[model samples]
Target: MTHVSTRPLEQSEFDIWQQAIARQFADAQVAAGLWTEEEALDRAVEANRTLLPDGLDTRHMILLRGVLADGTPIGRLWIGLTHPRGVAGCAYLYDIEVDPGFRGRGLGRALLAAAEATARDHGATHLELNVFGDNPTAIGLYSTAGFEVVTQQMRKRLS
Candidate 1:
């Protein structure tokens, strides 16, 4: 197994990473029947538009690219600081996606460990992430990483 390095994303890497994330979310939407292909595409387009502009500020909302020993990009992780009350120094684990070809090789675990270390270095006592109930793999990963659900949020879309 090769070691992975986390580095802030460059402006040139935004399009590639955005497309990758859009594809992943599209697949998830299709699998969950949450949207049709057209809907997924529209949503993806909007999402890309929203995120691509923020690539310039790689400090507060940092985007980290995970690279293999030989410098091949294998995954992406986003860590953001929280501003919610009573949650000082809290960090949000935004998006974590490992390339399909690199799944089940402990890359996800390594990426998460890196995120936790970053949070700790930033003076955070706790990290939080929102995982869909259907995403058992993510839930398992978070559980193994010592994160437990402090509360459950239920929502109903009225649209």
Candidate 2:
């Protein structure tokens, strides 16, 4: 497995990271049938703004950038150290991404491990994430990483 070093996101990287996250999230929502193509980006932008009001310094939020040993950037990870009700020892993974060119090299799994370690360092005993059903690759990665399904939702179109 390739080794990836993690570091706090730099100020200069914020715009690119935010744009990538917004676009990817909007695309995911559209693919999951949860949002219309025309509205997905706008909705994603608003949601991100609300979730990250303090940007890179959002309370209880961890935003990390992954790079290779030689300092080549690979991806990013976003995690919330606390749940909505102030649940103890719980962390929520909001997002993880590897540059398309870097996929399939175990970087995703590496990022997951990093995320877990980071959460644990912050006193998290459990980590949770939501992966859209359309993303089977992520589902498989999370499953292989010992994550079990806590809940699932199903829907059908009558059209």
Candidate 3:
């Protein structure tokens, strides 16, 4: 069996993770129709800045690096404590990524499991996230991980 573990994001690696996070937010927002590609890029920068004013030290957010038993870094995961609208206590998966070189291995599944354990430790009873509608791969993964659609939005482009 392979062993996967997570560690708190080190100060030295925060810069790289921050850049990747910006990209993820922009891409996800564009996919979800919440913003155009350009607008997503602009707003991603602004939103991330606000959410992570102190970088990894930001309150209510947990950032971790995924590594193999031998200490080979393979991915990053971001989880946050959030209360969306009527929901009172929940953990939101802000981001999760497996390095390009490490893709297709089940690292993502491991990361999600880690997120749940960490969230529980923080007193979160529910978990939530927003994934781009078009990404069936991610949707399927989340579904198998026990996440179901609580709400859905649809849009039509008109000529």
Candidate 4:
């Protein structure tokens, strides 16, 4: 396994990350009964648009690609700083995905470490994210990476 490197997301990689993020959200929404597949897809697309990185603000949002020794992109991690007040900042772990072929290779952990480093560099005091209850694998990964569940969003169908 090669060391994962972090870099600012390029325009060319935006669509790929966007699609991956949309898929993640869509899956979660469907599992949570918040939306049907079609509805979830639509909402994910919109959310992707809203979260697209902007360069104007000093708010740093980075997308990191984890590459194999030969440089094949096996995973991706991203972070967005929501607030930066003095030396303390708040950030969201926007996306973290390991390609199907790359699972079980510890690349996910590597990507997370990179994200944490990025957060520290940006003066972030805490990093946060929402994980679906169904995604135990992700929950475990996040837990191991030093995230605690501050709150859980529960839903009941009114229909």
Clashing pairs in 4: none
Scored by lDDT, the top model is 2
Predicted structure 3: lDDT: 0.83
TM-scores of the models, in the order given: 0.75, 0.94, 0.89, 0.81
Candidate 3's C-alpha runs over 4 A off are 31-33, 84-86
Of the two candidates 2 and 4, the one with more favorable TM-score, higher being better, is 2
Local accuracy of candidate 4 as per-residue lDDT tens digits, 4-30? 766555567766667777887888888
Q: What TM-score does prediction 4 earn? A: 0.81
Candidate lDDT scores, in order, read: 0.77, 0.91, 0.83, 0.74
Q: Against the correct fold, how does model 1 do in TM-score?
A: 0.75
Candidate 2's residue-wise lDDT over 1-159, tens digit each? 788879999978987889988999999999999899999999999999999999999998999998899999899999999875566788999988898999999999988898999999998999999999988899999999999998899999899
User: Which parts of model 1 are misplaced by more than 4 Å?
Assistant: 26-53, 83-86, 154-159
Better of 1 and 4 by TM-score: 4
Highest-TM-score candidate: 2
lDDT of 2: 0.91
Those runs of model 2 whose alpha carbons end farther than 4 Å from true positions after fitting are 84-87
TM-score of model 3 vs. true structure = 0.89
